[model samples]
Every structure is written in C-alpha cells, then in structure tokens.
Target: MKFLRTALGSAAVSHPAIDLQTSFTAAAQAAGLIKAGQQFDPFANENNFLLGAFIFEDVGVTAYKGAAPLITNKTYLEAAAGILAVEAYHAGTIRSALFTKGLATPANAISKARDSLDGPTDLDQSISRDGSMVNVTPTDANGIAFSRSPGQVLNVVYLTPKKATKGGFFPAGVNGDVKTSAGR
Candidate 1:
C-alpha cells in the first residue's frame, strides 16, 4: 500500500485511495466473525486464526499472479512480481504450519468455500498429503496456479455468489468503478 501510494504520489495520475475506515459488512458481523465494536482478530484461536492467515496469503499470491499479465509498466510489473513471490512464500509457510498441526480439513473447507464464491468451475484445491508427500502448492494438473478475475475475487471477499456492489467485508462497498462482484 505504501509503495503504491508513493508511486502514485510521484506520478501524474492521482487515483483515489481505499477507505481505511471501512467496517466489516453486516454478513460478517452476523456470522460472528467479529463483534460489533471489536477489531478483526488475527489471533482469535490457534486453528481458526491460522486458517484465516492461510486463506489471506493464498489469495494474495493468486491475485498478484492473476494481475501480472495486465500490468503494462515494467517497473510496476517487477514490483508486483516481487510482492507475488513474497506472498507465495508466506502462503507456503502458512500451509506448512496448517499441515504440521493437522488442520487440513478446515483449510480445505475454506478453500471450497472460496471456490464456491468464485465460480461454477471448481478451481480451488485441498491442502492434503498423499502418504508421505505433502501438498503445499495448490495447482492444476499442468502445475499452473489458478487465476480469479477482479469480480471473482470480489465475490469471495463479499461472501456471495450473486452479483453485488456491497456485502461481506465491504459494508459500504469498495471505492471504485470495479466495486461489483460477479454472480456465479
């Protein structure tokens, strides 16, 4: 975020920034993910918290990778690639931790939930092991990571398969033209 802010500040284009004061959507609150006044807890519990982290990191990696081809600026693309690498590393570490602690079932559940939100096609994978082989990286048969469109990504965050401008994480909606989530 700081990097983008700095880059934009140095450039001619002045894109509107994300609203930092945004609250969790009604759906999230009703689901008891967080209390009315409490902040989103990163350390809510051992398993649940790590599950959140796992989801976050994995999404970060895929989102970055998905956006790579759309980047026209070489410098920005390089920076994004660096960020993607870091996100991938973070995701791998989280997956390894979850596997070591035997949280594959819950992790897979979250993956399935995300998959359902994204689209009809099942692109998500389970964090599982085959005998002694641990499955850390979730990929296709060709070993390619899956990509989600902007709307698809929004669907997951918005917690809906229906087209929506607001719900789930962004109660007041995102602050740009691409605020709508795709209806699966």
Candidate 2:
C-alpha cells in the first residue's frame, strides 16, 4: 500500500466514507478486485487476475463518477478529467483482456449508468418535489433497522482534521503534540 501512503498526498475524505481513494484502496484489497502484488498467475485460478482488473476498472469508473460532483476546485476537476479518461482506457483494455481469457460473459459487455462522461453538476442540499431518484435526501438511514432509501451511508472511519495537508490525530497519521510536520 506504499502508493496509497503517498498518493493520498492531501486529505480527502476520512476512511469508511465512500470517496474515490478509500473505495479504490478497499477494492484493491477485496477478493474480486485488482491484484497488484506478486504471486499472480492467470492459469492458477479460473477467475484469476482478469476478473480483478475488470472489477478494478469498474471501481475506477464509478469512483470518478461518485467523486466528480464533490470537487469544486478547478485543478481538482482537471485531474479528475484525466482520471476519468484513464479509467475508461483501463476498462476498455481490461474488457478485451477478460474476453480473451473467457472470463467475461456476453451480458456483461460494456454498458454504463444513467450518468455518462459528465456527472451530476448541480448539487442541491434538500430534496426536490418532482419525486426524482436523483433528488437529494439527508438523514441517518442507518438509524432504522430496515429501509428502502438509497440514503444509506457508509461507516465513519476517520474524521477530517483541522488541517488538510499535514498529518493529524484522526487520519492516524502521526503522533505528536503539535498538529504538523516537524518544525512547522
């Protein structure tokens, strides 16, 4: 997870939240997700690395979709655009690779969600009266035992510390009296 340690250069969302970084990291660790480390052999298992790549690519695609709206900074938006394109390429290549390996079924052949290359732009704080699925709803859906709303939230794994760039208590980043890099 060295790349993770470094690539998370800035504090995004605290873990347990469904943001791009945590989702990608968790997907990498999952069984059906990408296998980056050693001991990877395609013939070893029927599902093998091919499936992992597909899942990873799929995760990448949706991750950008999930994250794009939250990003307000122009620089971040530019980076996200690049990431979105890269994800598309990754998915295309992996889809072909999976087909060659006979792992992908015909039904699973390339299809996307309702939102396309462009994502949700206008984010409203409250729900709309039109009864649209895309309308927003804010509530702790977890409070109820059973619910049918998509308002389901992820666990609060970490908290956004006072500072964004430096290590702090919540990210489990560093142990120190001063919230910072040394001598700052």
Candidate 3:
C-alpha cells in the first residue's frame, strides 16, 4: 500500500478508493448478467476479470501468430485479427503513457513491486531495466512485443511457478474452466 502511494504519488491516492463490490454489482446488473437476488463473488470475479484481460490480449496475439489456420471459420479468424490489432493499439497507448511518466523511475518502481509479488520471470520484466541497464519496452528477437502463455500468467496470479489451485490474486479460485493454475 505504501509502495503504491509512493509509486503513484500522493495526489493519485488523495481520494478514497471506489467501492469495488458496489461497482462490480452495478456493472453485472447493467450487463444483465446477474439477477436481482443472484449471488456472486465480486472479489474473485474482479481478480478474474483483471487476469483475463492479459490472457485475452495474449491469446489474440497468439491467434494471429500462425494459429489463424486453427480457426475453421474465416469470420472468426478475422475477428481474432481485429482483436489483436486493438490490443496492440491499447498496449502502445499504455506504453506511451508510461514513457511520458518517466519509465525509468515511477513506472520501474511499480514494475518492481509487481515482480516482487509475481516472482521473477521473463514474463514479468520490469518496464525499465532488463538487468543492470535501463529498458523501456520488452521486445522479442524480432523486436515484436513479448507475449505470455496462459501458464506464465497463472504463475504470476498464483505468486509462484509451482502448480496451484488458488492463491494470490484468486484466493477462492477463479470461476469457470480457467479457475485453477492447472487449468492453464
């Protein structure tokens, strides 16, 4: 918490945090995904949602990277391509923002904090500094943005590389097929 405040700066944390439970409930209701009396685990769902974003983005990219033929439907392949393009744009936007905010300082601090929680791994590379030198954006051998596999993502969420059913971001486990680390 203190690290978050320091990394994000005092002004960013000045206001009280939003009520995540209420917000999630309202969002579910608005989406017509939940009934008035239906029960839902907002905390787990929220964590799942956050983790799912990265998963979806990586999957979208992977779909276009020689896996396009796996999709029997041409329309679905096109949709996957579209999703990949959008995710790339979104990644660029985030990277640009981080660069503007001084990637070598605060962004690196936040990345270090995340790495500490997630455990050291190539997938959890720091925004600035690959080793002893500074690094802005991580790229593959061909200079393309790096992508993480589902297992790598689960490793981060579970806070360990070992197989896990639940822990870290998902204490009670995520919902559906992707609930456990083994599911990856």
> Best by lDDT, which number?
1
Task: For model 2, state the Cα shift of residue 2 in Å.
Answer: 9.9
lDDT of 1 at 72: 92
Poorest lDDT segment (10 consecutive residues) of candidate 2: 148-157
Question: What is the Cα root-mean-square deviation between model 2 and the actual structure?
Answer: 14.5
Identify the runs in model 1 with alpha carbons over 4 angstroms from their true place: 10-41, 129-133
Off by over 4 Å in 3: 1-77, 112-121, 129-137, 182-184
Error in Å for residue 52 of model 2:
0.9
> If the candidates were sorted by their lDDT against the true structure, best first, what order would they fall in?
1, 3, 2
What's the TM-score of every candidate structure? 0.78, 0.38, 0.46
Tens digits of per-residue lDDT, candidate 1, 1-184, equal 6776555355424443332223222223433444687554445577656776765677787888778897798878887888888888888888888888977776766676677788899877767745244578877788877777778877877778899987666655676457798887
Can you list the residue pairs that collide in candidate 1? none
Best by TM-score: 1
Better of 1 and 2 by lDDT: 1
Q: How high a TM-score does candidate 1 get?
A: 0.78
- Across 1-184, the per-residue lDDT of candidate 2 in tens digits comes to 3433344456443342133344333333333234555343433555555543553454455556555666687777777667766776776566556555554441132111111111222111112232232111212345311111111000111122122322211344422232232110
